[model samples]
Target: MTEDTSWVGPAMQQRVPWVKAVGITFGDVTARRVVAHLPDDPQLHNHVGGPHAAMIFGLGETASGAVGLAAFGSVMDRATPLVVSSEIAYHRLARGPLTAVAELTRPAEEVLAELAGGQRPEFTVTVGISDTDARETTRMVVRWTLRPNR
Candidate 1:
């Protein structure tokens, strides 16, 4: 069955104002993965003129959220997805426009099955931030939880 992922865009737009403030733009979005881009703007640069660390991190996080919403959106009525934790590492200096690719680390069906059995389910999304040249500059793993509504 095709997944109704039409909610991804509006979810990102309405839920995360901070991402918009940073000028992050989303690309391909699916149940398993998401891609986003951040333009290299002087206002977003760090002292060394690269995208600031926080802006890069936000780009990755937003990509992860887009995929998460695509994967678990059907269950929104019974559960609310929340980011439980995240770990990120900056690997190199990022320059020019940057891209972030995020993918779900666990099968959506598996997580949904656990939730159906009356347990909160947690899953991870891994994101890679790369420069215009396609060299990875940061890596992030964000853990998300689908908490059952009380």
Candidate 2:
């Protein structure tokens, strides 16, 4: 039987306290997308009293990583994920809590097929950070690759 890994998000925060320190909250996880939030708080506030840019980046990365794991966990059993590359675009300022949602640009099945074929697959995931009003404040694309665990 396969072990349930639904606790991945919270467990990761527990294992890496820094993530929790930045006020990252793990949310919905599915084969389609992964969601996380950066709550509004002093710890994550910037000079203008908005979420720090670094915090936004961190939240986006975390959300993308979760989506990758959810989509390719089995194929990654013998490998580990690495952030090969990433790009972020800041659209506007976030004045309150922000939500980050990440999902693959392509179909999960196609990416999995490449992995199943013994090819090291790389997928691009797009994360959109939105404010409490659901307006996009930041957008990021994270390219992930799996490398054999040594």
Candidate 3:
């Protein structure tokens, strides 16, 4: 199914208010990939003056949800998508603006087929966070499940 990801940012803002409250921005959202950004603000800085780890984690999680929505929007009538778990690791001290790129670990079509077979399909999205200089600063993996509606 083709999803118009242009609605991702706005929809996220409405459904997950914290994302917008934290000043996260979105770019190029597709079924398999979604990109999000977090501005470097003093209020969001950690002890060392870098973006706080929690904010960076939020950026990655939001990006994962964006891609998941893009991939599964058409099937929402029958299933409710939820995050099962997530793991994030900071690779370097993040400075300046940060960007997160999330991609599905498996093809959307395949996962959809599993749902069609009356199975609750679980998939993982891998997100890579980078600094303005294009240096990798963090990595995250979010596992999601599309629970069939009762």
Tell me the alpha-carbon RMSD of every candidate: 1.2, 2.5, 1.3
lDDT for position 88 in model 2: 98
lDDT of 1: 0.90
TM-score of 2: 0.87
lDDT of 3: 0.93
Q: Is candidate 2 or candidate 3 better by TM-score?
A: 3
- Model 2 scores a C-alpha lDDT of 0.83
Minimal lDDT window, size 10, model 2: 1-10
Q: Which parts of model 2 are misplaced by more than 4 Å?
A: 1-5
Top of the candidates by lDDT: 3
Q: Over the stretch 1-150, how does candidate 3's per-residue lDDT look in tens digits?
A: 655779888888888889879988899999999999999899999999999899999999999999999989899899999999999999899999999999999999999999999899999999999987899999999999999999
lDDT of 3 at 69: 92
Error of 2 at 115 (Å): 2.6
Question: CA shift at 51, candidate 3, in angstroms?
Answer: 0.6
- Candidate 1 regions off by >4 Å? none
TM-score of each: 0.94, 0.87, 0.95
lDDT of 2 by residue, 109-145 (tens): 8877776677777889999999989999999999988
